[model samples]
Target: MSRPRPGAGAALLFDMDGLLLDTERPVFEVFVEEARALGLEDAESFGLSMVGLSSSICQRLLRDYLPAEIGLERFRERWDAGVRARLAGGIPLKPGVAEVLERLTGAGWSMVVVTSTRTVTARSHLGEAGLLDHFLDVVGGDAVPANKPDPAPYLIGAERAGAHSRDCLAFEDSDAGVASALAAGCEVHQIPDIRPPDRPVPQRGQAVHRTLTDAVAAAGLLV
Candidate 1:
C-alpha cells in the first residue's frame, strides 16, 4: 500500500494483552473457572465484563459479585494460581503481531507499550514472548494515576516515546483501550479479541479491523 509518510518522529502505542499477546482468553478463562469454583453465578458474563480493565478495577468490581464470606483475597489467590499455571510455558503472540511489529520497526517508528497490566508483569510477559525488545518503553497501569478508559496510560506511553500523542498511532483490541487511546489524542485502530466492541467506537481517526495485519494495512504501514 502506498500512502503519505508518517510524521517525523511519530511513535506507535500498543496495548499488550489482547492486542499483542494472546493472553486474554486463557487468563479470563481462569477467572471464570475460579469464580465458578467459588459458586459465583454468571461467572463467564462477569469475567467478560472485566476485560480490558485494570487488575485493581477488576478486583473492586469482583467485590460486588463475590459472596462476602468468600473474600476477595481467597478468590484472587486461586485465580492467580490458575493463571500462572496456564501461562507457565509462555504467552503466545497474537495473530499478525510479529509481522506488524517488524513492518513498523523497519519503518523507523518508535514503539511503546500502553497496557492495563502491572509494569513488572507486563515486562515479564513481553520478555517471555520475545517481544520486549520491540518497544522502547512500557506504560503499565500501575505506572499511571489511572488505567484504561482513562487517557493517562496512553498519554504516558506517548511521553515515554518522546512524541506527542497526536503524532502516535495506537493499536488496541478492546473498547476501553480504544477510548483511552482516542482520549489521549492518538489515532487508534482496534482489533477485537475475545469480545466484539459493545460501545460505538468513534469513526474519525479511529477504526476497527479484524487483525493486526489488516489494521496496519489500513494505516498504510504495510507495503
Candidate 2:
C-alpha cells in the first residue's frame, strides 16, 4: 500500500453511508416509503435505528415491518426502488467534507472506505458525489461476511491500507461503526446524525461531531 499523507500518521478509514454521503435520511426515507405500503409510518425512525448493521441483518431485524403473509423480498424490492430514486437525486457530502478530504489528500493521508453497504449502493452515493477517486481502497458490505460492530471491516481496512489498526483513524456516524472500529483497536470519531431514544448522551469514547467536517477538523485531518 502507498504511504498515507502527512500529519495524520497513517490511514483514515471512512464509513460510506452517513460519513461520505447524506445516506441516513434518504435510506430511512426509502424504508418509510416501503413501509407505507404495509401501513406503517415512522419507518424512517425505526429504520435509522438499524443504521450500522449489515443490510441482511437489518432486514431480518426489521422483518416485523412486513406482514407474515407477505414475503420480505417484496418489501426489499420496493425499498430498493425508493433508495435508487433518492440516490439518483444525489446525496451531498456532509459539511466540510470537501475541505477536510482535500486538505488530507494534499497532505498525503492514505485514505480508503470501509462500509456495511453494498458496492452498488456505495458506488451510487460516492460516485455521484464525485468522491470516488479519494479512496485508495474500498471494502463493501457484500465483500465481507461480518459487518459493523464486528471489527472485521476495520481490520480489513487497516490491512488494505498497510497500516497498524491502532495507527488508523475511523470516521463513523453509527454506534455499530464505532464499536467495529474500536474492536479493531482503531481510534474513532463519530459524526452524530441523530440521538438515540434511550441514550441521552449517545455512545461513549467517540469524538462526537455535528458533521464530518467538524470531526475531521477536531482530528486535524485538514493538515
TM-score against truth, every candidate:
0.92, 0.88
lDDT of 2: 0.79
Give lDDT tens digits, candidate 2, residues 54-140: 887887876876668777888788787887787675676777787777777787888889999887868766877888888888888
TM-score of candidate 1 to 2 decimals: 0.92
Give per-residue CA lDDT, model 1, range 1-223, as digits (tens). 2343545767889999999999999988998888777677888778878989999999899889888899889888888898889888879899888877877787777899999999999999999988898889998889999989999999999999989998888999877898899999998988888863565554655788989999888888656
All candidates' lDDT scores? 0.86, 0.79
Highest TM-score scorer: 1
Give the lowest summed-lDDT range of ten residues in model 1: 1-10
lDDT of 2 at 34: 73
